[model samples]
Every structure is written in structure tokens, then in C-alpha cells.
Target: MRVRNRKGAPEMMAANTQYVVENPEAFKGKWAEKFGNDHPIHIEVGSGKGAFITGMAERHPDINYIAIDMQLTVLSYALDKVLEMNLSNVQLLHVDGSSLTNYFADGEVALVYLNFSDPWPKTRHEKRRLTYKDFLKTYETILVPHGKVHFKTDNRGLFEYSLASMSQYGMTLQQVWLDLHADTDFAGKNVMTEYEAKFSSKGQVIYRVEAQF
Candidate 1:
């Protein structure tokens, strides 16, 4: 497992701080116990270099944060931030987002964030897309009955694909923005990912939504 040490990311990383974990399996079943609180757990899947999740963790101490990514190199940078910020309420895990059920008990998570996930647009790679129905089913199992998936992306095809998948999984899209930065409340409310900041800075039109299963 090659961990990503993200010294190559642009200056935009300066503002986005987060915690990263190297070997996440060591902390299994300890998230609730370690946080030592019963706050709603909001998890960010595919959390890159710890930007968005970390920022959100810092902002919302009342909410327990768990950021999962398979890439260890980049994840370490995130963990470094947790140590820097001394956040007792945040946790990081290195795992496949597609294999969500392995980590959580049924109805354990309150919210799930999917930001700039791999589009996996090749027709044959549909199964690998994180928002595919199979993955949604996995998420539904771990998420509470009221749990929701908050997704953001610059890929139009994946965004549309996700919309269809969400509906197929018996989810209602609650809030959606075709152009996320159009003075929309979503842009104000969302913690932008590292790739999101780069895409948005380049005037990319990001599509986003909240879906309940």
C-alpha cells in the first residue's frame, strides 16, 4: 500500500486541515468509544488529503467525524492535521469506501459524504462506481434510517449516473444544485474538497445533491 504524501497539492490546501490515519483497521469498533461522545457520526468517503472532512470536523465539534480513504499516503497528511488540531472527536480510516458494511454496524452512521469520487465512466466499470446501486445498498445498511448521502462532483456523466442510481435505490433527492457555486446555499454550506476547490477555481460547474434512502 503506497501512502500518498500530498506535498504536491496546490496552495489551496493551506486552508483545508484534517486528520489522516495510516492503518485504519487498528481502530475498528472504537470510533464511538474513542470519541467518547454520542454525537451524530458524519463520515466522508473518499476523503482526499483530509481537507473537507477535517474542516467540517473542526467546525462541528458536536458531530463525530470519520473520514475513510484507501490511499494511505494522502491519508497520513490528514492524520497529521488531527494531531496538529488536537481534535478528540475525529477519526480517520484507510479502507475501501465500496466495502462500507465491513466497518459499521447497521444504522451506525448519520451522514455520508461523497466528494469528487472517481467518475469510473467507462461503461464496463459501472460496478466500480461508488454510487452504484450495490454500493448504495451497502451504505443503506450502515446508515441510520434517516441517514443521507451528500454528494458533489464536477463530472456531469457521473452526477447524472448517480442521480439515476439514487432513485433506483429508493432515495429521494432532497437538495440539488446544477451549478454549485452559483451563489447557492449549497456552496455556502458545503466544505469544498481539494479537487473541488481546483475545479471550482477553474470555473467548473459542479453538480450536487442530498439523497435519503
Candidate 2:
């Protein structure tokens, strides 16, 4: 998502430093301390505009959520939603998903979410996919033992690639949904992201999976 820079967006995010952690690396393994509780930490890697992360934080008060995204413009928009909700269990991190280890210690995270990520479909760009082996390794290092990655996407190719990649990496596939929105039970419990809702309304098939590593 190429988010055009919005005027004063950076300034707005700067003013809300508490919700937007500008120096997340400083917290590192102290994320529990940052949240003022030892609650389980669950993070969304490309948490665009913060819908899923903030919604999860509101729904699950026992879990702390960190929204990680590289785009400042998107982070700014996400910061607004968090503030509007007065959500205390959420924080925004302006960083790339590749830098997960720099901000989290080994076995520090309980769950990781990858929602509507860029597929990087070209064969040559395979490594850029979030479910690529290298990225999975990073998730393994940061997540607790047997920690799970819950992923959702509307692209069939990406879903197939992710399932194959996770299986090749020796991760256990606990659940797989070929058409997530078609299942009434799962759809009701799912926190739909902006992209997911948009695509689903157009009758696109959404795929979801839970893989434990």
C-alpha cells in the first residue's frame, strides 16, 4: 500500500508519543514493562491503518497489541484510531517487519499476525514474501515456543505459497480456511481489516491459516 504522505501526519503521530513508540528498540525485551503488565504480547506485522490490531486490543484486554508498519502515513492514520478509541493496550511501531528481532527478544511474543500482506508474486521476489523461510525464521526467534502465526489473504497464489513454505519449514498447520468469510462461525469471530472487508465485499475468496512453529 503506497500511502501518500498526509500533511501534518508526522506531527500528529509525534504529539502522541505514548501511543506511537518512536524508539521501540529501546523497549526491546521490556515490552511487558512498557505495557505495565506481563500480559501476552501479540503483534501484527504489516498492521496497515491499525484496524485489526486496535480491534483485537479492544476485544482482548488481557493481550497487548503492537502494530508494526514501515509507512509513516499509515502509522499516522493508525495512531488516530487508537487515540479515538482510548485504547490502552495498543501501541504503534514505525518499523519494518524484518527488524522484529531488534525490538523483541527471543521467545518474547505470544502470537504474530500477517494480514493481507504483499504477496510478491514474482519468482525472483519470493524472499520478499512475509511467509518466506527467512521471515518465518525471524518469527520463530521472537515468538514463544510453539507460538503461532495467524495469516489471512485474498490472493490464492500467496495462500498456497504460504502453506507450502510453512510446511517446508517444519511448522505445524493447525487450521486452514480456503474461504474464511464463507464460514459463519469463523467470520463472526474474525476481526476484519480494511483490506479484507473491501475485498470480501467484492466476493473475493479469503484464505486463512494458523501455523505453529
Candidate 3:
């Protein structure tokens, strides 16, 4: 993950969202039961500040969402958005994404969203990268047949690695685009995460792809 020199964000972000879960054990199973996690779940791993997940949840009411992020400050903002919107489909969690098995059952999720995931630019930190092969296998277990992982990143190396990892896992690349922002619809549809806003503003081209599970 590339650490920004700017550690904090706007005051609106903190005021925009609130922290919903402090612990995962008591809430995970019950929430899953309430929403029937087995029913077409789409998750956003490391959903920063919640704009994308909230927008997605609002758009797709039929599919349930379980958005996970490790940062309390960030998750707080996301939870508040869901609560403020009175959206029933979106669920927020503060947990280590690498420990996904603890919450989701086999063939539970329908899709995994990797929006601008940590680049882990250094070679030594490849394992820490979310799109690593180990993480793909974990996703495979949770997703049903034809389930997919929708990945979008501005980092070229991570995009290449993710594509290779997905292929190595026998997952098909259903669609891919090197310059997602070049597409008018994708660019106009601004689901404003702090990082997404910053990266795009700097004129970085976004890379996106969907891998079938």
C-alpha cells in the first residue's frame, strides 16, 4: 500500500460516515443470517470511505453487499453513508480482508470488488498485495460458479499481476480495459473514494478487468 504524505482527509468525510462494527464475531453470523449471505453477495474488499460501495448498493438493491476494510476511520465514513441513505442491502465490517473465510461460507459471494487495491509496489511485499494468487484462491472458495472478481486499479504492475493470477487460477478474463477512465460512462460515474478522486485528478489512467470464477 502506498502511504500518502497527506495522512488525513476532509472533515466532511468524518462527518459523512460513522463506525458501525467494532467486532466481527457477534455480528458476522447474524448479519449473514439476516441477509442470507448465501444469496448472491458482492463484496468490496478494503472499501475506502464507502462512496463506491454505497453507490453500488443503492444501484443494485437485489444483490447484498458486505464491504470490508481494516481502517476504523475510513470504515466509519462508509458506515455513515449506508446508514444515512437508509440502505438495507449494504453491510460494513472492520476486519482483516485476508481472513475472509471466518465470515463468508463456500460459494457465498457472487462477486468481489477490488477498486484501486493496495499496489504493494515493492517486490518483497507481493504477498501483501490483495490480488495475489493466495487471495484469488480464497475468493474462488467463496464465489459460486461463474462468480467473478471485478478489479480496478491505477497501478500497472498490480493490474498485470492480478490478470496473471486470475488466469493461473483458471479464471477467465471476461472483460478488460487498460484505460477505464477513457470511457465516458466510467469517468462520469464518480463514486468518490479519497484515493480514486486523488489518483484520477492527477491524470492517472485507471485499469479495470473482470475475472470469472
For lDDT, the strongest prediction is 2
- Model 1 / residue 107 / CA error / Å: 0.6
What's the C-alpha lDDT at position 14 in model 3?
Answer: 44
Query: How well does model 1 score by local distance difference test?
Result: 0.80
Candidate 1, which segments miss by more than 4 Å at Cα?
1-30
| Residue-level lDDT tens digits of model 3 in 81-142 | 88789988877776899998887777767889999888888999998888888998888887
Please, what is the TM-score per model? 0.87, 0.99, 0.83
- Determine which window of 10 residues in candidate 2 has minimal summed lDDT: 180-189
| Candidate 2 global Cα RMSD | 0.6
lDDT of 1 by residue, 73-112 (tens): 6776777677687887777776788777767778888999
Q: Which residue pairs in candidate 1 have backbone atoms (N, alpha carbon, C) closer than 3 angstroms, thus clashing? A: 3-72, 3-73, 4-73, 4-74, 19-78, 19-79, 20-78, 20-79
Q: Which candidate comes out best when scored by TM-score?
A: 2
Please list the Cα RMSD from the true structure of every candidate, rounded to 1 decimal place: 4.9, 0.6, 4.2
**Candidate 2 lDDT, 1-213, residue by residue in tens:** 798888999899889988989899999999999999999999999999988988888899999999999999998888989989999999999998998999999999999999999999899999999999999999999999999999999999999999999999999999999999889987668999999989999999999999999
lDDT (CA) per prediction = 0.80, 0.94, 0.77
Q: Better model by lDDT, 1 or 3?
A: 1
TM-score of 1: 0.87
Candidate 2: pairs in clash = none
